[model samples]
Target: MGDSIIGGPRIYSCYKCRNHVALHDDIVSKAFQHVCSGKKEDRQMMTGLHMVADVHCADCREVLGWKYEKAYEESQKYKEGKFVLEKYKIVKENW
Candidate 1:
């Protein structure tokens, strides 16, 4: 057999780490396991808001900033395995 298809709207890659995360996946639920019961900083950072703000790279573990609505638009300009421009999107504007 081949790989099974995971149902979701679409997967997105982290700009810093290139880690792929499905939009429909339970990212908040997963991050909670690490964010909670960890350090005070992490717990304070998590706030446990579910979708409003929650995203981290599973690879490099870099905390992705808010504004996921524009991830796809930004990623479209670059190919996979490409480096994310450091200066781009500093203002954290939406797509």
Candidate 2:
């Protein structure tokens, strides 16, 4: 957890520790969580209504944030299959 990749793609790490927390990339890829996801439910976000699943860290089991499972509004469709990490809990790793 302490070792940093010499020339790795820049990622986000937990501010509280050197734990691999999240990835900050332009590509909107579906997060493959072999670990786990909380129950899927619809919630009204600032942007719009969305069905999201709470994502958990496999290593430390912390509440990383959520995955956008489904977007109800057409304008918010792009957010589907993306993640939302807590801004206050993460820091750029290699940037």
Among all windows of 10 consecutive residues in model 1, the one with the lowest summed lDDT is 32-41
Model 1 misplacement above 4 A:
1-9, 24-38, 42-55, 65-95
Cand. 2 TM to true fold: 0.70
Over 23-82, each residue of candidate 2 has an lDDT whose tens digit, in order, gives 555325564433357899999999989999987666666777888999999999989888
User: Whose TM-score is greatest here?
Assistant: 2
Tens digits of per-residue lDDT, candidate 1, 1-95, equal 11234443333455654455333233333321211111212222132322123334456655544322122234332321222212331222121
lDDT of 2 at 68: 91
Candidate 2 lDDT (Cα, 0 to 1) = 0.71
Estimate every model's Cα lDDT from 0 to 1: 0.31, 0.71
